[model samples]
Target: MRKAGWNPIWKWLAIIAMIFLLAPLAIALLNGPGGSSGLYPSPNAYETISNASRSITRLPFDYDTSDDVEMLKEYVESNREALSEIDKALTQQSRVPLDYTVPLDELLNASGTVRLPMRLLIVQARVAELEENPGAAADVYAKMSVLSPKLATGGLLVHVMIASAYETMALEKLIELTPRLSAVEKKRVLSVLTTNARKPIDFDLVRERESDYCKHEHGTVRGSILLWSGSALVDQQVDRAIETDDELLRLRDEAIDLLGS
Candidate 1:
């Protein structure tokens, strides 16, 4: 009689164990694989950017004084070929292409590398401004403004945030330089800002890519359990990020309008 009672208990324990084991599997299966099947942008610009990122030397000081400008000029001359390639790439397309299938580490590495060129551009703009060529400075800022949007497109949240930062930096520089720019240069800069403001970053796509990244990271059973359990919180955080991006873009547009006026 004791053995019979023990058998039911063992069976119940087995059922509970199975439920624990299979629940994550079931959740993962139901969610299906994340990632998009849509066509991505051409990799040419991204390839160029990656190549350019390799040749850059980190600048230690801000591009403020004549000495700083000279340092920037030296950096620019040293990375001239790479910077040229980046400029050519920028003219070709308005979006930075990334292989979403790459590992998280690779994407993070890319995030770090891509910012070098933006820094280089800022240096170049400052050099021009200090040289008393406000038109050239405005041109560099315009390119920075345009490239900022491109970097955010078809990227993860980190990329979007980086782009947003660059955009703000470029806008501030342009605003400071606007009074010095010729009427034609001001109009051109205003036009670029207007166009970029109109095409806001697509947070929907960013959310999807983020989910895909999580799926990629948590493919194992143990990982899946953690992911499945924490997905609600992850999604909530992502939504909050999206809202933040929306507000930032709105303010950016308002700033652009002020630039135009």
Candidate 2:
């Protein structure tokens, strides 16, 4: 039987709830140009990542093919200049906590698009992994969580696609590297995650039907475990994260079986 929480209304809410974090900066950009550019990653940067992602023949979700890996490497190598631009842009931004609020509709219709730095950082992290540099890879992923503080380690398509497949991949890489990370590195990872974890879905918000959020918490648990299969550090954290979601427990054994854990 399907989990009780996996109903249509909750599922619909899950899709839009996560976008709440972006609303403030989105409206800021729409209203004026001052400081907004620094708050969000440049459109050019996301374009670079998106263009490179498209260079691969397979879609972002496809990871089983050796060819796909090679394609990713090629894309990363050819985009050094673009990545440099992203690095410089990130260096210019202040990492202070931003506070602002506007109605949900105002954000939904905000002009232009500003992707989170997580998009570019994900590609950078993957390149680091390809270069056999785990430390660099971990650092890149850590920056992602810092850039987008509202993203949580949840939902396969819902949360992962909040930016791109790169977002999801970065989270997975972070989890996989947890056991080998140093004390300071572990602290950074934990700090960013704890700071950015998403709030529980509110049923009243769902009933209003004016705002929306995604809610595939089970997918979050399964995908997280599959990514962190070999790491004791991450397993403990993932266990704790999913323990709060009752539905995830019902699906845990099946997820483990599917991932061959």
Candidate 3:
């Protein structure tokens, strides 16, 4: 459903007054929602990616002391069990949308499973493998990234997964995929990038990416971010800095252009 708004002229004027005002939206509906490389794998692909990553030749016997490999193993095995069911849920075997299809709760049925620390490192190793060999990685991380969001314990894992997706070209094809991410998830992604990743991508870039991908779609993750970015300070200043109310209006109009239903 689209959000109600004033007619274009009024909307544009407000936007001009506060260009950053629309930054809260999560989706733009125009040209967003793809990762770039065009590789949108199906649910089956995801299973294949996750499974193949753990070839008999490259298995992590155990993680650090902070991790419990037994629990991790149980979780992985549980997820694998869901794979057969997930394969049936696919609208397309090669590119099934997995935003909600993968059952995190069902996958976590084991009392012996480790929640994240252990899986995070395992996910990282899989991502590295994806970076080196996409075909194998495709059989490994591409689908794994899609599913990781469901399994992600917090922002750190999400950030690592997103980064790994990009570094590995696993998600190079789709643009607007925050299904695994939340507003909080995005903030975390930004924080981690700002603090750790050698090349940090800021929140603004993330917003821009959503805006770019969505191209003005209503109710999408990108639109939600813009509508609720809550950047009053920045938005207010942007509103006042305009040389003229008319220019302000133009800027507002541009932002509003993104506020479609």
Top candidate when judged by TM-score against the true structure: 1
- Tens-digit per-residue lDDT, 31-79, candidate 2: 3222221244334333443343343332234322334557666655665
* Candidate 1 lDDT over residue span 1-261, tens digit each: 344355778999999999999987787787645645355556556566768878887664655444566777787788788779778767555344556567778878777656888888878887787778987887788777777767666677787777777777776677677777777877877776666444656677776676666766767454556567887987786777677667656656654665577
Worst 10 residues of 3 by lDDT: 149-158
Which regions in candidate 1 have their CA more than 4 angstroms from the true location? 1-22, 35-37, 57-67, 94-103, 195-198, 220-224, 228-240
Off by over 4 Å in 3: 1-47, 51-62, 66-261
Indicate the residue-level lDDT of 80 in model 2.
Answer: 61
C-alpha lDDT values of all predictions = 0.70, 0.42, 0.35
User: How far does residue 47 in candidate 2 sit from its true spot (Å)?
Assistant: 12
User: What does each candidate score in C-alpha RMSD?
Assistant: 4.1, 18.8, 19.8
- Count of clashing residue pairs in every prediction: 0, 11, 58
- Candidates 1 and 2 compared: the better one by lDDT is 1
Task: Please give the lDDT score for candidate 1.
Answer: 0.70
lDDT of 3: 0.35
Which ten residues in a row are the worst by lDDT in model 1? Answer: 91-100
